[model samples]
Target chain A: MNRYSLNQATTKYWSLEDVVAASAKADLSWIGLWREPVQEYGVERSTKLVTDAGLRVSSLCRSGFFTSTDAAERQAKIEDNRRAIDEAAALGTDVLILVSGGLPSGSRDLDGARAMVRDGIAELAPYAQEAGVRLAIEPLHPMFCSDRCVVSSLGGALDLAEQFPVEQVGVVVDAYHLWWDADVYRQIERAGARICSYQVSDWVVPLPADTLLGRGMMGDGSIELRRLREACDAAGYDGPVEVEIFNQDLWNAPGQEVFDLALARYGEHVA
Target chain B: MNRYSLNQATTKYWSLEDVVAASAKADLSWIGLWREPVQEYGVERSTKLVTDAGLRVSSLCRSGFFTSTDAAERQAKIEDNRRAIDEAAALGTDVLILVSGGLPSGSRDLDGARAMVRDGIAELAPYAQEAGVRLAIEPLHPMFCSDRCVVSSLGGALDLAEQFPVEQVGVVVDAYHLWWDADVYRQIERAGARICSYQVSDWVVPLPADTLLGRGMMGDGSIELRRLREACDAAGYDGPVEVEIFNQDLWNAPGQEVFDLALARYGEHVA
Candidate 1:
C-alpha cells in the first residue's frame, strides 16, 4: 500500500509531542524526523512517543554538509554524521539523509569542493553501513548549489553513489530539487532500486525572498504530483513518500491545521 | 585592453539614446541594448546613436523562449527568433542570445520540453548562421528553470551546442547563472573559444522578492568576478566582458549614475 510520511520540518512550529499527536490523529502511518527535535525531547523519550503512538520511523532528516576544504573541518563533519547514523539506528530509521554543502568560503574552486564531498561521503559510508542506516544523498535545488549542495542533479548524485558499495550509498529524490530537470524521468529510471527515499513538494514560481523558508505545500503550487508518483512507481521505488514543505505561511498556522492540510492534499494529489 | 559594456536592463529607466550617451560619457567601449528599446526608438535611429557615440553594440539582450509543447506555438517562437537575429545583425552585434523556456503548461515531460528546445534552436540556427550572428545559449539561474530557461548549467548548454554546428551554436557564460555550478571552471575551460559572450554580475545573498528584478550590481554581491575572468582568459576567451544586471532599485536610478557605478565597479572588481 502507498503510504505518506510527514517530514517534521513541514510543521516546525510544532513540538515533538504535537507532531506525534497530530500524526496519530491524521492517521498517518509513517513519520520522518529531524535531529534537533529528537535532541530537544531526548532521543529515548521521542522514541518512546513514536513507539507508543504506533507510527513507523521512515527516515531521519539529515547527516551531511560534507563540502569543507579544510581537512579538520571535513573530518569533524564526518564524525558528526557518524553520530547521526547512531541516532538513526537508535530510532530504527531506514535511512540517514545527506546534503552536500556548497563551496568553501572565498573559493571559486567548484571541482575541488566536489572532490571534498566525494571524500567526505566515502569516509562516512562504512560506519553508516555497519549501523544499518542507509546514507541517502539529497540533491538540493540548484539554487542551493553555492551554499548548500554541490550535488544538484539526480544523475550527479548517482555519479557520486558509484564511488560507494551498492547497499551503502543511495539517493533521496525530492521533487522540489528535480521536478524541473529535463532528464528527471531518465535519471529516475536509472536510480531504480537505488532510490532510498522519495520526497514531494511543489515549485512556486518567482521564488520568494528568504528562499530557505519559502517552499510550497503539495498541490498548492505547480508540480504535477501524479506524474511524479507515476515516475516513482515505474522506477520500482516503494518507499514512504515524505512531505517536506518549509513555507513560512504554513509553518505559522496551527500544527493540526498544517497536518490536516498535508493529509488531505496528499490523498487528493498523490494517493 | 579590458573594455566594459553596459547591459541596458541594469538601468531600464533610461531611454536607448540616454543609455548610449551615458555609455559615451562613462568612456565605456560598448553598450548592450534590449529589444523593446530598439523597437521604441526605431532600430536605424538607435544604430546611428550608437555609431555617433563611438560605442560598439556588444550583444542584444535576448532572443529565445523556445520550449513549447504546441507545434504551431513552437514554430511561431522560431519565427520570432529569426526576427531577433535580423535585429542583432542590424545592430552589428556579434551574438544573439537564446534562453530555453521552461516546461510547457500541464506537462511534466522535461525531456519532451528539452527536445522541443533543441528542435527550435536547430530550426532557428541557420537564420542566425546565415546572418553571420552567433546564437549564444544563456543558461539562466536554475531558480528560473521552471518558468525561464530550462538550460541552467554551462555544461548543459555546451551539451546542447555539441548537437549543432559549433559556429551556429555557442553559449553566453553569465557569471550569475554559472557561478554556483560545481563544474563551472572545467565547463568554462571546455567552452573556450565557443563562448560568444561573457556576462558579469553578482549574486547577493538574501535576495529580495521579485527575484527576476533583484539582481545585484557588480561588487555589491558575493560573486568572484576576477576569478571567473581569469578562468575565461585562461580558456582563450578574449571577448569584451558585458555587465548585465536587472536590479529594480538600480533601474529606478538615473542612467548616468548607473553607468558610472557599473564602470567603477568593473574597473575595481572585474578588470
Candidate 2:
C-alpha cells in the first residue's frame, strides 16, 4: 500500500484539491501529478496543498516534444522542458516523465527524428541534473510511433538514457506502453537504477478509436502487471507504482470511485 | 515491373479470378493469393487460372495459428499447416507466410504461448521442407502482439527462423508492420537469404475501429517504402515486392481503381 500512487490522469476529472484531499484522507503516502493542473492551480499552492496533506508527489506527468525539425521550435520545446523540470523540483519529485514527439509533420525521416530526440535530451541532461530532477523517457506503444513518440521501446529509451549520467536521465516502464514487448523482462533488468517510474495500466483490445484513451483499468486486460512489478523490484526499482490509466470510461466515472477501484485493483493485480 | 506483385488482400473485394486477370492485364509477372479465396475457388482451378494467365504466384497469404494450449488442438494446427504447405506447393509458390497466433484464451503466459509457436513450427518444418514450401514468419506489429501474432519484430522472427534451415524457414519484411522498429534495417541486413518476402504498405494514423484494416496504400502514409525495398535488395532479396494493403477505403473503392493506384504508387514509392 505504501508503494501505490494514483496518477492524476487516472482520475482526470478530479480537481487538484480533491485528489490531494482524497489521497490524504485515504492515508496514501504518495500522489502523482500532471503539469497542466498543477500550473493552473498555481505550482506553489498545489505543492503546499499536497505537503500540508502529508502526501508526496511521485512524479510530474510529462515534458518533452523534442522531435521538431525547426530550430526555434525545438529550442522553445527544450526551454519548456526546463520549466517542467523546475516545476517537478519545486513539487519535491525527482522524476519528470517525457513523451518524445513523433516525426516532424509531413516528414518520413524516422532516423533523423530519433536523432533529434537524442540531441534534445543531451541539451536537457545538464539542466535537469542541476535542478535535482530526472528526465524519464516514456516509450509510447509503436502504434503511436508516427505521431506521438519516436522512442517506441524500452531498449530504445535505454539506448538514449545510457549516454548520460544515471542521475541525469532515466526511462519510464509503463506497462500499458511496454507489456507487449518480448524483450521487456531483459530490458527491465538492464534498466536497473535508471528506472525512475513504474506506471501501470491494462491493455484491453479492440482498442477504442482514440487509441490514446484505450488503456484499461488494471487486471481488465492481458498484461502480467504483478510479474512486471516484481521484475522492476528485482531490477532495484522500489519507487511508487503509479496507476496511470487514460480510458474514457474510467475518466467518465466518479473520481473517488475510480480512485478507490484503482487502489483495490492495484493491490489485487500489481502490488 | 518484373519485381512487382499485387497481393490479393489489397483488393479484398476482387475475386481470385478477377485479381489474377487484372494482374495479368497490368503486365505484372506475379500475384499473391490468400488461403480462404483460393480454397473457396478451388485451389487447383485458381492455380491453373493464374498459371495459364502467365502470372506466377509470389506467395501464399497465411497458414499458422500454433499457440493453442490443448494438446489435441496443437496437433490439429500442425496438421493444418502441413495441408497449407501442400497447397503452397500445389500453387507453385515456395513461400507460405505465417502469422503466429496470440496467447491462448484466458492466459497471460506470453512466453508459454510463444513456446507453443516454436514447437508447432518445429513439428511442421520437415513436412514443409519436403513439400518444397518455406514457412515465412511475418512479424505483425506489436499492437497485434496480444491478438494476432507473437512474433512482433523482424529480429524476433529471425530468432525463430534461424532455428531451421533457411530453405525450411524464413522471415517476411512488411513495411507497415516493421517501419517503427529502429533495429529493422540491421535485422534486414542480417536476414540476408532468410528474407523470403518483402511486403510494402504505408502506415496511416488515426487507425480505424478495426486496426487490421488500417494499412494505407504505398504512398498514402508515413513508411519509407523505397528505402525499405532498397534494404531488401541489399539483403539479397531479388524476389517479387508484394504490395499488401488492408485499408477499408481501398476495399470500398473499385478494385481496378485500387489496383491501378497500387501499381502507380509502387513505381513511385516502392519500386
Candidate 3:
C-alpha cells in the first residue's frame, strides 16, 4: 500500500479535489495527476489540495507532441512543454511524463519525426532540469506508431534518452505499452536509475472502437503485472506504482469504486 | 515483373483457377498460396494448375499454432504441421510461412509459450528439411503479440531462426508488420539468406472494426514499401516478392482489378 498510487486517469472523471480526498482517505500516500484537470482546478489549488491531504504527486500525466515539420509550430509545441514543466515543478513532482507524438500529418518520414522528438527533448531538457523535473519518455504501443508516438519501444526511448543526462531525461515503463517486447526484461534492467516512472495497465484485446480506452485494470488481461513490477524493483526502481488504466468502463464507474478496485487489483496483481 | 508475385490471399475471393489464369494472363511468373484454399482446390490439382500456367508457387501461406498446453492437442498440431510441410513440398515451394500463434487460452506465461515454439520448430525441422521445405517464421506486428504471434519483430524472428539450420528455418519480412521498427533495416540486413519471403502491404490507420482486415493495398497507407523491399534485396533475397494483403475492402473488390492494382502498386511502391 505504501507504494501504491492511483493515477487520476484511472478514474478520469474524478475532480482533482475528489481524487485527493479519496487517496488520502484510502491511506494511499501517493497520487499521480494529469495536467488538464490540475490546471482546471488551478495548479496552486491542486497542489495545496494534495499536500494538505498528505499525499505526494507521482508524476504529471504528459507533455510532448513535437511532430511538426513547420518551424514556428514546432517552437510553439516546445513552449507548451515548457509550461508543462512549470506545472510539474509547481505541483512538486520531479517526473513529467512525455508522450513523443506520432508522425506528422501528410508525412511518412519516420526518421525525420524521430529526429524531431530527439531535438524537442534536447530543447526541453534544460528547462525541465531547471524546474527540477525529469522528462520521462513514455513509449506508446506500436499500434500507435503511425499516429501517436514514434518512440514505440523502450530501446528506442532509451536511444533518445541516452543523448541526455539521466536526470534530464528518463523513461516510463508502462506495462500496457511494453509488455509485448521480448527484450523488455533486459531493457528494464538497462533502464536502471533512468526509470522515472513505472506505470501499471493490462493489455486487453478486442480493443475498444476507440483504442485509446482499451487498457484494462491490472489483473483483467494478459500482462504479468507482478512479474514486471518485480523486474522494475530488481532494476532499482523503488518509486510508487501508478495504476493508470485508460478504460471507458472504469471511467464510467464511481470514482471511489474504481479507486478501491484498482487498489485491490494492484495488491493482487502488481504488488 | 519476374520478381513480383500475387499472394492469393490478396484476391482471396478469386477461385484458385481464376487466380492462376489471371497470373498467367498478366505475365507474372510467381504466385503465393495459402494452405486451406489450396487444400480445397486439391493440392495436386492446384500444383498442376500453376505449373500448367507456367506459374511458380512463391511460398505457402502458413502452418504453426504450437501454443497448446494439452499434450495430445499439441501433438495433433504438430501432425497437422507435418501435413502442411507435405503440402508445401507437393506444391514445389521451398518456403512455408509460419504464424506462431498467440499464448494459449488463458495463459500468460510468455517464456513458456516461446519455449513451446522453439521445441515445436526443433521437432519439425528435420521433417521439413527432408521434405525440401524451409519453415518461414512470420513475425506479425507487436499489436498482435498477445493474440497472434509473440514473434513480433524481425529481430525476434531472426533470434528464433538462428537456433535452427539456415536452410531449415528462415523468416518473412512483411513491410506492414515490420515498417515501424527502428531496427528493421539492420535486422533485414541480418536476415541475409534467412529471408524466405518479402511480403508487401500498407498499414492504413483508424484501423477497421475487424483489426485483421485493416491491412491496406501497397500505396494506401504509411509503410515505406520500396525501401524495405530494397533492404531485402540488398540482404541477398532475390526470391519473388509476395503481396499478401488482408483487407476486407480488397476482398469485396473484383479479383482481376485487385490483382492489377496490387501489381501496379508493387511496381509503384514495393518493387
What are the chain A TM-scores of the candidates, in order?
A: 0.97, 0.99, 0.99
True contacts kept of 2: 0.58
Q: Write the per-residue lDDT of candidate 3 for residues A1-271, one digit (tens) a residue.
A: 9999999988898888888899999988999999999889999999899999999999998899999889999999999999999999999999999999888887888999999999999999998999999999999988999999999999899989999999899999999998988889999999999999899989888888788888998877889989999999999999989999888999999988998889888889888
Q: Superpose all Cα atoms of candidate 3 onto the true structure and report the RMSD in Å to 1 decimal.
A: 0.9
Query: What pairs collide in candidate 3?
Result: A102-A148
Evaluated at residue B63, the lDDT of candidate 1 is 82
Better of 2 and 3 by lDDT: 2
Real contacts recovered, all predictions: 0.38, 0.58, 0.52
What is the descending lDDT order? 2, 3, 1
Query: Which model is ahead, 2 or 3, in terms of DockQ?
Result: 2
TM-score of each: 0.87, 0.98, 0.99
Give the docking tier of candidate 3: medium
Ten residues in a row with the worst lDDT in model 1 chain B?
B105-114
Kindly give the stretch of ten consecutive residues in candidate 2 chain A with the minimal lDDT sum: A176-185
Clashing pairs in 1: none
Total clashing pairs for each candidate: 0, 0, 1
In model 2, residue pairs whose N, Cα or C atoms come closer than 3 Å (at least 3 residues apart or on different chains), thus clashing, are none
Q: What stretches of model 3 exceed 4 Å from their correct place? A: none
